[model samples]
Target: MDFRTQTSSLDALSGVNADALVLVLAGDTLPVGLDASVAAAAKDAIKLGDFELKAGKTLVLPRVAGLKAPRLVLACAGKASLKSARSAVQSALSALKSGGTVHAALAFAGFDSLSEALVEQTVLAALEVSYVYRHTKPSAPAAPKLAKLSLLLGKDDAKAAKAGLARGQAIGAGIELAREAANRPPNYATPTFLAEQVKALGKSHGLKVEVLDQKAVEKLGMGSFLAVAKGSTEPLRFIVARYEGAAKTVAPVVLVGKGITFDSGGISLKPGAGMDEMKFDMGGAASVLGTLRAVAELKPKLNLVAIIAACENMPAGNAVKPGDVVTSMSGQTIEILNTDAEGRLILCDALSYAERFKPAVVVDVATLTGACVIALGGVRSGMYASDDELAGALLAAGDAALDPCWRMPLDDEYEEGLKSNFADVANVAGREGGSITAAKFLQRFASKYRWAHLDIAGTAWKSGGAKGGTGRPVGLLTHFLLSQVR
Candidate 1:
């Protein structure tokens, strides 16, 4: 979509002879000048004629008095209520997609002082909602269609607004990358293939990317991450990407993602039911790489790093067995009581290794626990943080991105659930509070820094592809990192 700035009235814009012109009305509104053309001069006693427009409503006006365009779209901007304007914008976008070529003009004449950020967000929402991805499916519903987008600002203060559009496009592209990765069959999106994807993303975005093949990961003592890959012919990979765009003195913000390109549950086999969705086990990695793409394009004044522990867990002669004890790089020993609880196992080593950077903050996102899905359903991801500030920041960032999140507790008592008779901790705690125990397991390695964990099991992939991949934490995480730098 293209966004252009216009500084003219509706009447003056009639000469452009464009496809369509969208007029946005702000407030408890009424639609006026519907039948009139751009060439028609305003009359002193024109009748509004019960054309009262409601807040958060949109009406299409066809062929006004003197304009060459075939139709005129009037969108409502709801009362200057908190976040109501955003809902109004979303509604407008939905309406705009129904019409053919979109060239919109939002003239906020009577609204109270509106922030530039709000405008940017509104515009971003419109263009974003206009897209649909249904190419491969045979019976996919036709997504909404639009060719171009134009925003007629009430004021000529759109200099800061362009960043929002750019960020939105980058984020959308990142989401597509993740969706494509998720859409691929497990045989194709192997550990090696995922590693290559990360490297290509890095090269395109100016990030320094590195892939540690199996030998290198073993050398780093990534026993648990490597163990998951032993059963697959595809080799394991520890992918790292660094973006040093901040001051030399600043420590990087580390993001560790669990990348099980495909999970077969190894010796601790999973039920046959719903195993097909295991392909999305790598959603966390996709999100991390996608956010990196956005951060690279935005180039916020902060150093960023992404560590993805990539592998596939399949039952084979060499696969790590249950009751195996693996020592993480941090010297912590974990008893693998259940092979299915492998995400935390891989993340443990990645988290420990992230400590080498002495980062300002460390956050790890994973499709870690089914318990999280039970707790939050598929709408939101469960957030567990060791620090109050990081947790608060994540919730606030989530609000800004319109992807809401709820904070979950990480009580020290849950650590007891992970107690192991033979090792320092057990990979799988009992059934109770499984999500909290998983968070506590990861918290062990992140005890040194302000850290947060996002268990994205419920939010990564949707049953209805039309809902689109929730693409959850990436938007919130990217916004949070941007806030840190600004």
Candidate 2:
């Protein structure tokens, strides 16, 4: 859909006519003067007692003689929240479906410090409907799509609003990319498919793409990552995409994603029930790629590197058994106690490889543990940062993006769970502090850089009814990158 910015006067909206004009007011009342035509139409609706403006109240009314539009949508939802605002926007979009063009006006002055949030969330909410995932079973019936979106100003200037709209659009596009990758079936989105997707993304955005084969990965001694790939017939790929907008001297931020394309727990197989959802085991990898997609579009003056260890973890004779010990690129040996806990194994080597860049920071996103799903649930991703300052920065970015994250402790005591008798560390680290210990395992190889771990097990996707990748942490990760460059 086309999105544009315009000033908040009747003259500005006079030349253009929309199917529906969505006017958002503050609290339970209309503002003193919301565009002359809009105000007159709303006043008529109020007089008829058909629509009383109040908190969370929404109404669709016929446009009066003075208004240029055929219909008017009054959303009395306050600018207090992204969720509520999105609901209001969905209503406006639904109202405008009968017509081609849609116009939206929100009271920016109504929000105090949340002006930017209100603008960004509203735009994001409108764009959220743009991603229509289709299936063989009729394609969710196809919602009527709008041709253009005109954002109207209420009681604030146009500059900041325009900036927020651009930011939201870029982030939204990135989320769309992530969701598509995560939603695809395992057969269609294998390690090879992921490598191809990264190359396509790089070609479109001027990024340098490199795909390392199993032989190449073995040469680098990524034994831990290769253990999982050995069982799958589909070829393994260690994909790296670099965005070098900054100078060579600057240390780039490195993001590592666990891209186990379809994890079947290898030798320690998972339950047969709900195995189809394992397609999203690569959600972490998808998120990093998604974030890069946005970064490419936004073009920040910061160097970024995405390391994706793409492969499938299947149970076969060649699969690493529970007793197997593998040497990582860092020369650390890990005892594979439970093959289900494979994300950390791949990420450990990737983290060790990140040191070559002398990175400013290294963050790994993974669907690491079910323990994290129990701790944080579906709302937030579990975060474990090496330093408090880095954690604080990520938290702020997550908050701004509305993709919230909760920080978990990275105490030295958790390392005890990962102690191995035959190797340097054990992959599972027991069931007690599973999530924390998993982070501790990855931390062993990332001591050279300011590192952070995001366990996106719960937030990456949904189960049951919604059953698709939520396109999470892409928002959080993208916002964090933008914050650093800004």
Candidate 3:
């Protein structure tokens, strides 16, 4: 959608030509800046108990006397805060979905002034509510008609609001790209398919894209990654994409993603129920591509490299079985105690491969463990970092982007759970603290540099009515990368 900033004044509102006007109120009393007739209409509605000043409440007026817009929507934010503003925008947009409105002007009342945080959150919420998945489902309803959005702000806040709109648009596009790839079925979004998507993104953004086939991966001694690909008939692809906005000598921020496109638990098959959701196993890989797209669009003055170990984990005759020991690119041995724990196996080699970039920091994203879902639920992604500084930066970034993550303990004691009887380490530990053990397994290969892991199994997608990819952590990752820009 096209977004721009407009002056939120009485004269400006008089000339504003949109199908609908959204007035975000911070309290019960109307602010002094709204158009006289529009404010009177809203005040009358509140007095008659037609609308309450509760958070996320909405009231629609078919026509306001003096406004150029045909419809007026009064949305309650309850208080002046970024979170409330976002919810108010979302609530207003949700109410307009079935209408014929094509453009909406959003003006905040009773707030101090429009800030970058407010505008950015507003745009992000609009884009998120506008998303509709219709790629595979031909009979799905068409998306909403609302196509253009205007954020009404004062003249002093125009510059900052414009910047926020740009960032929001870039990040929103990235989220859409991630959700599209993740929502596709396994047959349509295979390892090769993902490599093709990366190449396309690279060509458009002037990035250096490389896809390592099975032979090249084997040449690099990625036995651990190859083991996960053995069961699938489709070929495996290791993707490396580079965005160089700075000097080549600069140490780049490396992002490694686990790309198990369709995980069937390999020789250890998962239960039949809800197996279709396994297509979302590549959510980490999707988010990596999404963040790269956003960073490339913004042209941050920092070098970035993305590494994806794309493959499928299936239960076939030649699939890697439990009790098998595999050697990784780092020369570390891992015992396959449970093939379902394959995300870490592929990521170990990918993290080891990231060392060649001489990275300043490496953060690997993966839908790693179900135990993480039980621990943190869907509210936060499970984060495990080697140092406090890196963890704090990520936590702050998540907070700034409204995509939150909680740091989990990584004490040396957790390593004991991953002890192996024969190999250097076991891929799977006991059921207790399964997520921490999974992070500890990946930590073994990231010893060469500062590293962190995001276990996104619980936050990547939803299961019930909203059974689709949420495109999570893309915002968090984009914010984190932008924070590193110099």
Candidate 4:
């Protein structure tokens, strides 16, 4: 474990021995106390303008004559907001590619305005940059190892800081899990394979895990979820992992994930171009499992249940046709107007299943629409919620975690396009309000409780050279759960 927490005074910090001592310089704000002294010591460098500490800037200084550490990283924290401060530190950590051990005093001068949440965000962002995702290459490439990352905290806020550090590490581990799963190829990451992995993970983590088979799904009348699975040789898999950290009576927060391990659009085959990227279809399920992984370590005083509807959408003789209609577990008949629009079919069933728990809230994550990627680009997730307070809480959580979401219209007007001549609702609402229509479809099944939908298509994974799962929303989900506990 390279992550550790320590508290040191501004005066004592100068004498401590470590690789790099990170300091933050807020926008146009003069350094004070230890910060001022550190600057004064490096006055020549500051005066000569050897380094700049503008917002989101990073400058590395080595061989300081008087400083105990050989390196000093000055990160610019504009306005000292959590987002800006986190990015500043993130840039510095990324620059230290050959990481050994670094002593970070990121909250050094912002003590009065700095809270534990801010410290936590900084630590997690640092850890995030340091993470190296690998795959089944011929051999593991040698990479820089971050042996240790110690956070320098204020004496008064030491306790909260320690808590934040722990939270950061746990969430980081969870995110790594999500990224790993999403990065795997479709052939290697089948529906049954994912369920088996989740079952094994629960055993290791001491969580209550149950994998429901196709028979179980048939018994529940989940035709909509199963229709998508019929094309692939892989069996349908649904995972329900429960973490009861609070009292038995407490209603748990339910998270439903779309797990179409590989989507070939079934009989509605998509164009061959970029089809390999379908491996990332299960990003939503990976995130749910990732959040549970963190919760297992954090052990907060809140009960939670994570549900994944796992399957594959492939073109085959048995594949469901575009004109077919299937009934969901909720007895709602859905017209399969387009085979490519399958994420919502799986999520709707899981949402209906969540009603069994009488959850306090329900949120389903899915890479449901290409429209989301077009709308939000690669920056933020698209969110839709009927309840204003739930939507607002999620927005606040995203802000705190740096995994932001923009609320799109969940207006009833969009549902009209889903009108089907043959069924209760069409699986898709043409291409107009695609993302919002997808969210609206899932909303019908989750009306039993306060609910939110996260359309993570844009934010889940990057394309091109950095192509891989981003492990989004895990940080957002973890932060939101912790808030509920408080």
Whole-model Cα lDDT per candidate? 0.75, 0.82, 0.91, 0.83
lDDT of 3 by residue, 128-196 (tens): 889988988999878899998988877799888988888898898889999999999999999999999
Please provide, for model 1 over 246-326, each residue's C-alpha lDDT reduced to its tens digit, 9 standing for 90 to 100: 787899999998899888788999999878789889888988987888788778899999999999989998888998988
Instruction: Find the candidate with the highest lDDT and give its number.
Output: 3
Q: What is the TM-score of each candidate against the true structure?
A: 0.87, 0.92, 0.98, 0.94
Off by over 4 Å in 2: 10-16, 35-56, 63-65, 79-83, 94-109, 112-116, 135-140, 154-156
Error of 3 at 309 (Å): 0.8
- Per-residue alpha-carbon lDDT of candidate 4 for residues 1-486, written as tens digits (9 for 90 to 100): 366667676666567567887776676654555644466654555577765556766677776666787777777777767777777778777767665544443435653554767767876777677667666765655555545667776667767777777887888889889998998888888887788778877899888999999999999999999998989898889899999899988999998998999999888898899999999999999999899999999999999999999999999998989999999999999999899999999888899999999999998999889999999998889999878988888899898888999998887888898889999999988778789888888888888899999999998998999888999989999988888884
Q: Model 1, stretches more than 4 Å misplaced?
A: 9-17, 23-27, 31-61, 66-68, 75-91, 94-99, 102-114, 130-145, 465-468
Best-fitting candidate, measured by TM-score?
3
Q: After superposition, how far is residue 298 of candidate 4 from its true place, in Å?
A: 1.8
Among residues 3 or more apart in sequence or in different chains, the pairs in candidate 4 whose N, CA or C atoms overlap within 3 Å are none
In model 2, pairs of residues that clash are none
Candidate 4's C-alpha runs over 4 A off are 35-37, 99-107, 110-114, 138-141
Candidates sorted on lDDT, descending = 3, 4, 2, 1
Give the winner by lDDT: 3 or 4.
Answer: 3
